[model samples]
Target: MKFKKQIFGFMDMLRFKKLVPNRREALANGPADPLPTEYRTNVLAHRLHPGRMEVELVDAVMVTPTIRKLTFRRTDADAFPFFRAGQYVSLQSPVGDSLVSRPYSIASSPREALENKLVLGVEDAGFFSGYLCRDAKPGDRFVMSEPSGEFHYETLRDKKHIVCIAGGSGITPFVSMAKSMAEGDEPYEMTLFYGARTAQQLAFRDELDALSAKGLKVVYVLSDETCDGCEHGFVSAALMEKYVDIRESSFFLCGPQAMYDFVLKELAPYDLPRKAVRKDAGSCGNREVSDPRTFRLTVHVRDKVCEISAQENETLLTAMERAGIDAPNKCRAGGCGYCHSKWVRGEYVVADGRDGRREADRKFGFIHPCVTYPASDIELIVPVGE
Candidate 1:
């Protein structure tokens, strides 16, 4: 039976009078065990987002003359955290006097990651890459950052059909994407356009073809040479129109600066919405100068401060790496903001089109060491490496 307001008020006051007594009685009768020192939620979170992992190279094969497909297994854990299909991981190892790291897209599917297997496609174009491609053998240990990147598919922001364009070693992420689609993890239909100089240079031709039979669309485009049943030209808009309506589909591009320039120029005429296109960032390399000068670089990692020599044409992150200082970095492309540090004092400049810092970060004197070069003797407070 419902009570009137005045009766409810009286009942509440009577309950309040017995509240202390009731609480004491319940406490006395409660279980004697103490509260848990750890939580289940915290344990699951740590398992999924382990920031860094120690991995061992288990296998390495030359997919092409220049690119090597390397497989790794985590030494610290039995299984790696599952990641998005198109995300990347940064691998770090000491090469000679310098401690170097580079970001490479994951070529294995996320399902394979759960089985403690992950793969990377490394092109032997740089000093560290050459070492990894040729010298690194099975059983060698390396530090691997957990899969991290914004280069994956999103259900809300992207369309159902995604047209991917790759040049040279840029086909790495699409390998994972196709595998993920075949595994029923991703919801998007993938159409890949892989462009290379010749038919033999097309890495993963057999694997991509096998996936194509499983519903993924594959197009092999050659520029210098062609074979039977392949598109014989660059990956132009005109060529794409023959198979898919690019304007109605989202685009994912990964390649060199020249390829990006060409594809972007081709799409400019369509006046497509900016969100319709997604391009993976390329790493920043040393600037070309006739005569480069070395300047003093003072770095502060926590309370320890060290001064080293930095080159005028190199980035601050490069100087830190050459000095064997473990400064935190991921993309090394000035994007991701993983290497953002405080600018203590320096005459510096961010690489063109590589500045990914927020406006508030710029206003607060934050700098991304990965893309920033020392114009003069410089000083910075770098974050401790993960």
Candidate 2:
């Protein structure tokens, strides 16, 4: 036993000696350079998930009195990325000092994105829309994130037959999908049900007709105007039942908040599975929450706290903009997650259309201040942006 113990001690000493120089060498070498690892990982991530689609405005055309289609082309053709037909692009822009973002559905088909083009239509209202209508000109550069959103048809999840309900400018995504199907870029049968106040407000009428002539089915439901051949009424359960085969087709709804509310009640009788119904990221407006209570907002950024009064009727982003604080936001509707911020301490309420917070964020008490409102005195850790 003693002899074996001596031999073990000698072996242990040799192992210790081997470890000592390697430790010193490692210490001398210091920390490993992270750049190569980071770069390689980033490259792989880009292959898996492309990033930063910067585009330049090539042209703009007024499609209707309240609608304008802006055409953008890739600044670098070599890096242009592809997108699904019904996806959306979140745009970043500087509105005076505050940076705001808005996401518009890619009105152009996926083939267009592959061809380095993206066409989007915006209603001529609000901050970004006003900026585009009044100030945006040709050759202007627009920074957009990669195409995102999951409103497209999935073979495994969605039915081959689609019943699309659109109101106002919500027809954009369906237009893209319909065009793709008509062009044989996608294989699916679609029945589009579009609502408008009048025929004049119906955008892409000629394009829709052309696509319909090429096998896409379209039904226009006009509310205010009466035509001999067209349907004249709101898109209700009776209308849908008469026009759509609800048992075999999946439903897609895109419209204003009011329309959404009305349609939700209209659809209650269908009793379809939750997965069978989908909603577009609609407008962000608090129509039901009247007489909201105002509160104070204290934001901490870079160890500096700034106090601002927040109006109950206005969005947190709007209030911050009014206070002249540069808040980074894209897609004020809360879908893009660009305006993500940590809530240090506060009680706030995110409006309905703007409550797209992820489950992990809800667990972590993070909120998209762009769509959130101060329900009480609150402190937030916000990132300062242009």
- Evaluated with TM-score, which candidate comes out highest? 1
> What total of clashing residue pairs does each candidate reach?
0, 1
Candidate 2, residues 1-386, lDDT tens digits: the string is 99999999999999898898989988889986654645877765674356566689889877878888888987854444566788887776667766666778888887767677788888888887878866888899877877778888888889989988899888899989998888788778999999998888888888898898888888899999998656999989899888778878888888786888888888888788899889887546443557777788887777788898887766777777667676766556787777688898877788864678889999998899878877787878887653
Model 2 stretches astray by more than 4 angstroms: 1-50, 76-80, 286-296, 301-309, 321-331, 335-338, 352-360, 383-386
Candidate 1, residues 290-309: lDDT per residue as tens digits?
69889999999999999999
